[model samples]
Target: MTGQVALVTGGARGIGRAISERLVKRGMKVGVGYSSDPTSAENLQSEYGSDRITIHQGNIGARGDCERVFDEVINAHGRVDVLVNNAGITADKMLTKMEVDDWDRVVQVNLSGTFYMAHLAYLHMAERGSGRIVNISSVIGEQGNAGQVNYAATKSGLFGMTMSMAQEGSRKGVTVNCVAPGYIETDMVAAVPEKAIEKIVSGIPMKRLGRPDEVARVVEFLADPESEYITGQVYSVNGGLHM
Candidate 1:
């Protein structure tokens, strides 16, 4: 993967950060895309050296921002060989309590944002006849969560989108795959109350929460050129919680 370029949306923190670091360790130049803050991303670039890591800031929910970010990445790195659609937002609310705005916002950032970035990357990769696109989903998407209807919907949507995109990209040597991670130690998961987290962990067969690097490992595998024959599949990292 040396000299290859990768664009990782939401690459500034949590699971995204682990993925970005892993790719860089594997000798790939990474474009780290963050929605609002650039501190983490910039810090990563500093640690990895600016030549190996480039920071890009934009709201993935907007098509215009997606276009500009994509162009910026390409302009900085010359080409993109892998795209990780890891950017997403969640507006948790019970179905009845959920406001229209809450649903719309989550849908826009999680589903629509992924589509915008993937669509752009797909075109570039298909034209080049080689590429990998990995979508970061969640275990909640597989097993619907109580207060996360909107989030679950968008994450589950990626499954169908992955299959269809895989078929379309197969002939062109591009692959699309989804990674559904269980409760990992991310800032998002950390926000849950301690008691809630304990309850969640007790249900996992492994009797523990997953680590971000654990999820990133699967993503790293999927992004490898050796994974060309393994598209349109979902690799669960949920520690037997959902499977």
Candidate 2:
């Protein structure tokens, strides 16, 4: 994958950050799409070298921003060979109490954003006859969770979208797949009440929260050149939480 260009949304922190770093270490040029946390984004750029990685600051929820990020990456790297849709947010609320804005924002950013980016990247990949896309979904999407109707909806939406995209892109040699991570130990998971966290860990067969790097490694495998036969698949990195 040396010299190939990869774009990772939400690449400045957490699982996305780990994916970005892992890809760079494997010798791929990377474009990081980050909405905030300039410090982390800048650090990635500095550590990876400007030629190896370029940080594109933009909100994935907005179509125009997604366009800009893609344009910037192509302009810098010549083409995009891989895309990781890792940009997402949680708006936790019971269905009745969930505000309209909260639901809309999560859908816009998590579902629509993935669609927009994938559409654009698909076109480019089609022209080149090759590409890879890995979407970061969640276990709650498949199993469902209380107080997370909006979040669960968006994450589940990714599964259908990935399967469809994989079918469409498979004929063109462009692969699309989804990764459903369980209770990963990230800042997002850290916010859960200690008791709830304990309950979550206890439920997992591994008896522990997963690390971001564990999820990142699964992404790496899907994005690799050797994964040509794999498409329209959901690889669970949830420590057997979902069987």
Candidate 3:
């Protein structure tokens, strides 16, 4: 993916940030899109400098905001070669206990946000007749979580979207795929109770939580030119946790 122009949504931290840095290190001009967190974006800018990195602030669920970020990067980099839909939110609750707001909020950001970014990126990539898109899904999306019904739903929806998009983009020389991360060591996972975390690790054959870099590495692979022929596939980086 070297020399490719890539955009990473929710790049302020976690897997998104790792993906941004990895793509940048590979010689790509990266667009770091975040809903907020100027400090993190500023840090990325410092590392990459303004000439190579463009920091965009916007809500991924908003089409206008998505367009703004796309335009910002296109105007600066001249084109978009890759798109990573990594923006998502979690509103954990059992189905019986989930509030309407919780369900709506998580769905809006996680599922709809991916659609918005892909929708906008599709327009650009379709025009160019080439691009790569990776959506960050969750293993929970495959195996439902006890208290994350809504979150799981959205993520699972992303898998469906990924396949459909891959079919559409294939005719245009674009590729779409998804990465399902299992228990990545991000701030979100850090919130789980110690014992619960231990239980999670024990279930993994590797006996450890996955790292953000683990997820990012998979994303980078899919973004590669050789990967152009492989689309609509779901690659799991769960350390045997969800197999």
Give the per-residue lDDT of model 1 (tens digit) for 31-141: 999987778888888999999999999999999999999999999999999999998888898999999999999999999999999999999999999999999999989
lDDT by residue for model 2 (70-115), tens: 9999999999999999999998999989999999999999999999
- The best candidate in terms of lDDT: 1
Model 3, span 87-196: residue lDDT tens: 99888888898899999999989998899889989888999888899999999999988999899999999999999999999999999999999998888999999999
Candidate 1, residue 211: CA error in Å? 0.5
Listed in order, each prediction's TM-score against the native is 0.99, 0.98, 0.97
Question: What is the alpha-carbon lDDT for the whole of candidate 2?
Answer: 0.94
C-alpha RMSD of each candidate structure in angstroms: 0.6, 0.8, 1.0
Shift of residue 46 alpha carbon in model 1, Å = 0.8
Q: Rank the candidates by TM-score, best first.
A: 1, 2, 3
lDDT of model 2, residue 197 = 96
TM-score attained by model 1: 0.99
Give the residue spans of candidate 2 off by over 4 A. none
